[model samples]
Target: MNRNYLLNDAIISPLGFTTSENLTSIRNSETALKLHRNSRYFKEGYYAGLIDLDWINSKFSRIGNPGKYTKLEKLIILAIKQVIDPSQNFSTRSSGLVLSTTKGNIDLLNNNDFSADRIYLWKMAQVIADFFELKQKPVVVSNACISGALAIKTANDFIESGRFKNAVVAGGDLVSDFVLSGFQSFQAISSKPCRPFSNDREGVSLGEAAAAIFIDQEQSAVGESVHYIDAVTANDANHISGPSRTGEGLYQSISRLFNNSGVDPSKVDYISAHGTATNFNDEMESISFNRAELNYVPVNSFKGYYGHTLGASALLETILTKKCLLNNELLASHNFTESGVSVNLNIIREHKRKELRTALKTASGFGGCNLAMLLQKQSL
Candidate 1:
């Protein structure tokens, strides 16, 4: 079925409230991350993509039960408001809600007052649906790091399946004691900003953010419009917790997206990579880029600007990638030098100039999940 599918609306995070402001930040390579000294554990002062929650609360004061919500809820609501204001969309009939996260409400466990198993993945869905009072059933996707991209995939499916007239898909996660302690356990925390695919690359900096996208088949012709050309999810069954060192899963995901979308790899102008700056992730991405023969396509990572957002990472990165496609601009990879992988691909070290008609956003998750999305500029 050649169903009607599109990514017409969005509510992004860690950059700015509006598309223009975020795009400007990307062009200037200005980062939203800052070293925080909060006593929430993990006090080595990691760079975080800080959100102005105070501004959000004051701006959307009329939202329901605002005081009862947690920081995660507040972030979700803020992004929700960007797409469907309670004053409008809430009063309507049932709408679809897809919330993605790896570890929902992990901040609650910091005080030793809460437990981990209590955080069932499905609870994330209920929390958001109740907030808007839309009478809609919410779907939650908890695929570790690939959660965000999977949320987008689910939204696209529902829209194409005629399950709802439209949908609100939000991705959110926080950098709390739980995540920081775990990353530190794995020895994945970097003292300074990360450098992806570089010989001097260290581990990733963990951060938190919430982003929402309103995808619908209806063309309003009034709002800012962009398309999610095609997306796919693939798993490396060989490894339960780690990626295929050969980049097999990543390569398969991109190959599938291209084959499904009928888009050529050589035609892809830019790659919004999941360059986490980890030794393994960068190498895998480079291997995949080489196999796909997309080395000429300039590449960059938002991790330098917005740590590894975990569940919300891919969605946030895709929003930035779409911005580049809309503007035909290429961003730098922040800290990078010396090829770690055997590939001739141009790993963009500085903001490069280019015309992007098509761009690909790729992500990999724990539990062997990998995903890719192909996007194209709309011909006006």
Candidate 2:
């Protein structure tokens, strides 16, 4: 199998506009979630991490023309433009684009100002590909919350299969009245900042963000890049809205990830979990980790810092995980006050330093979908 490496990346979130800015804010234990009493998304005030559209427009106009792109499209283009360097001689024919999102322009459907005819996922993808001038047909993945992680895996597969030398993977989802009301109807939106694995946890806090990551089969210009060792995705089909009680899908995904990489469980330094703070989701993760014998590993959830982020969570979290490996530190599982699940986990409570060699990222989403990926620091 060909080795795949993360070349460069960028993030556009409420924490900060750049990757470095977001990392700094997270390290400081700052959260982007805020109380929006007048939000049109829900009847009462809802806490969410939202990007200022006015700010987005100001920054976007400096880079390219506006009105031609939707808010989501502008976000994707902005993120990709930040990390992509024009000096690099990679060919458009050999490079591809992959986008991940759960609800692409679903908000446009209810808007009388915008035509619903332009709301198709493929049409949105074509706009992005044309903006970046990628020659290859764009790939779009919308598999619940695992969409972002699966997008990276898709890019890795394409590069490893000799189909493309490089791929630009961008994932994002904007919070809107449509999505918020849907979660609200399910009673899954937390009233406060979500506390993953905490006894008093309520539910998930939705967030909006756009992030782009570049992957290539060739050596990275950036020194000592993280390598994509392997990834596996599984489905339990327990329910359309809930995960399997036994965590069967997640267990199988993690098992296959290690089996494919031949990496010992003891070597995994940290776990970036899909801790949505909801009762069932967090409990399901505890069960999955224990079954994999990974309970001893230090774990943390980024949801407390960025809210759920929906489709952007996995990709955004992966970029932050790479930063954690680089810094050799484990960030705390923010807002966790006590153990709430049956299975015990070594959830990090404070930022601590450690030599991280290997890490695992996992996410389980609606539709009983699960994804696990192994990342290793490039040996110097």
**CA RMSD (A), model 1:** 3.1
Error of 2 at 153 (Å): 0.5
Candidate 2 wrong stretches, greater than 4 Å? 40-43, 86-89, 112-115
lDDT of 1 by residue, 279-352 (tens): 88888888888888887778887888778889988887877776777666788877667766657568787776
Report the lDDT tens digits of candidate 2 across residue range 1-380. 76688768899999999999998898899998888886665667888899999999999998788777889998989998886774273567778888999998877886755556658988888888898788899999999999999999999998878677788899889898888889989999998888999999999998999999888776556567688888999998688789998999999999998898899888999999999999999999999999999999999999998999888999999998988887898999989999999999999998899999799999999888999999888855
Residue 358 displacement (Å), model 1 = 1.5
Assess candidate 1 and give its TM-score to the true structure: 0.89
Worst 10 residues of 2 by lDDT: 83-92
lDDT of each: 0.74, 0.89
The local lDDT score (0 to 100) that residue 315 gets in candidate 1 is: 83
TM-score of each model, in listed order:
0.89, 0.97
- In angstroms, the error of model 1 at 367 is 0.7
